[model samples]
Target chain A: MCGQNMLDIEGLVLRRGRRLLARRIDLRVDRGAFAYIVGPNGSGKSTLLRVLAGFGRPEEGVIRWSGRTIGEWGGAYRGEVAFLGHLEGIKPMLTPEENLAYRRLLVGPTGWRVPTPSPFFDASALPDLPCQRLSAGQRRRVSLACLEHSAAPLWLLDEPLTSLDHDGVAALGGLLARHLMAGGTAVVASHQPLPPTLVPATVLELGTKR
Target chain B: MNGLLGAQLRMIYRARGDYLAPVIFYVLVASLFPLALGPSPRLLSLIAPGVIWIDATLASVVAFAGLFRDDYDDGSLEQMLLSPRPLELIVLVRVFAGWVSLSLPLVLLAPLLALWFSFPPPILPVLLVSLVLTTGCLTLLGALGSALTVGLRHSLVLLPVLLLPLATPVLIFGAHAVLLAERGLDPRTPLYVLAALFFLALALIPKATAAALRVALEV
Candidate 1:
């Protein structure tokens, strides 16, 4: 793992089609920092998270992770990131257990730092069943399970709160708290306000895009 | 690296049922030509090279829908896009796995299919060689097409349109080589062209497909 835990975004200008989504934005997040990028519908929350995740290039900006430019880091940076986009990324034909089984491979060698699913994980009804048989909330849980044992220090979650039940929401908050306590960083893009029980995080809410 | 490849192989293995449809489609298509043209063995032998080549190409297109569709729909594509594994290598492995599971059967089954066409037995080896090499080239091109269109709605139509112009050369050289082998003439020229295409695809298409996949996944 790199010795640094900082994400520095300077003068970020994001666009979609001909419209300006979010522009001239700057933010800095240090190790163990939890950040929420809140925005209304069509406000570029997903686009911004995607840009930071290296899925989409911003029109203008520099994003630095652990002191290296994400571009220069290139494929190496992917190993350091656990990105969960709007989709659960689940294979409907495979069981939940089968899906997350590939996580270690995708992230490369995690050695012994793979986080085990704990009592707080609420993995009660997740395994064994083909993912197609699961409900939306159940599918969300299975997808989040990928992050439960993630070795990557950076988590880029897009709309993680969608379709989650109260219990599922609390489980996610607990996981986030644990990740923060362990010195990892998370960038959660959601329109929903976080539950009351979670730890405080730096909030970067984007105004509505007309 | 082993883990990544293992997981990819596992996914392919688990989806063994999916590989059947295209091969079956290939046979069904080949069967139609014999029925349409009547039972004349002489005529069947005459058109055999073109008939088999067309079906093989179409059968690969049948396999194309599955190439990236499952991953894109269920979100595994996102995981793959962001995985620490090099996108180019991931694409290469995907194409390789696809060829092994999906196209290898078509290659193995070609001799039997060739019998239906009354293709001269002497040319079977040459047919297999052409199938194996052409299959690799098609899979590479098909993958690049799949990656480019994965994020689009109604890309099934778009895929073939994008692929056909590029695929015309593969068809020309592949079928021509098989015909030359049939006639007992030296098929070296087209065989060399197919080899060149395979190596070029091996070196270049993965990077292009990877870049296309990145664009497809972008919002």
Candidate 2:
């Protein structure tokens, strides 16, 4: 995926109500690179992530993917990016396996069905249970499973490590390394350090410009 | 299209327990009015229209809470918002799912409730017709309410306040239709009005709900 920059943000500004969260920010995440976005609380890290993922439009500036403005990228084109916000985004009523299967159908290639034995087939073996009954770390793992299986070429994660244990964090780091190694790109927003193994990542500190 | 619809249906059915609870509440509420009014057939008949209409209206409001709360709590709403599918289409599926899980049962059980109130036999068809149309309108209205209160706590109070006023037309038409039917007069006028209201809601509410959800999510 490194032939071109998969994500480009220039002169981006985001505001919440009367407060200016971020201003005049420029960021770029190329194909196959892991980029980290860090800032203190209310630093607009989530805002920037939302804009980059095409969920929230920037107050001012342009976000482009592969040379086309994000707004210009139609549904099919934008589908190439997977976003995980602070919210776990997994339905509590659904089991871990069902959540993954549902998301697989949503963002997977059109006409794609969950494979007979899903990659996360192991999730089904644990128990027939609702996600709310699962531990926070377990829910996070289920969400990560969905992200891993998504065919999207770019990933935008907000606080992806919020509820993970040491092993879970390491597993996520492994997933990120594998994704990058496979030529996929990612922009992660977090206050925590990523696993040491995934190196040479570019870091952008929001609000540092002021 | 298939994915959005299928996901919505699955999510709604998974909350089957919550959905069924409101229908049971509706039956209980409808039954209490007759007993409280002392079982006088005249008194029961006199208030039956209002009783059924109130019961159905309250049931829809109660079920509306489950429409977006589960999805919001589970993070499913955020996931859907970011999906390749148009937000409008996704919101439509949600509204459809809410109707299927919450409102559909109420319509189906209207006959039984009507019997309990000893509604005139001739009025039964009109009651069912009014319910079918009103349920469609209520579902759309409820979707709008759900979108407004997406991430807020105490949404239970906010939902009814926002929805009940908007639902007045449905309640009015529904009760009137039942009254006309009981009089053995043609209830066609109110029934047609309710159908038109449902169509108007169907044409317009999904887009409104979608826009509301987008704004709510951005905040």
Q: Could you say which candidate leads in lDDT?
A: 1
Runs in model 1 lying further than 4 Å from the true structure: A1-3, A116-119, A122-125, A208-210, B1-6, B13-18
Model 2 chain B: worst 10 consecutive residues (lDDT sum): B65-74
| Candidate lDDT (C-alpha), each | 0.81, 0.79
lDDT of 2 by residue, A125-185 (tens): 4456888898887888888877877767788899989888887788788877777876788
lDDT of 1 at B41: 89
Pairs of residues at least 3 apart in sequence or in different chains that clash in candidate 1: A89-B75
Counted clashes in each candidate structure:
1, 1
Query: After best superposition, candidate 1 residue B80: deviation in angstroms?
Result: 0.9
DockQ, candidate 2, vs. native dimer: 0.54
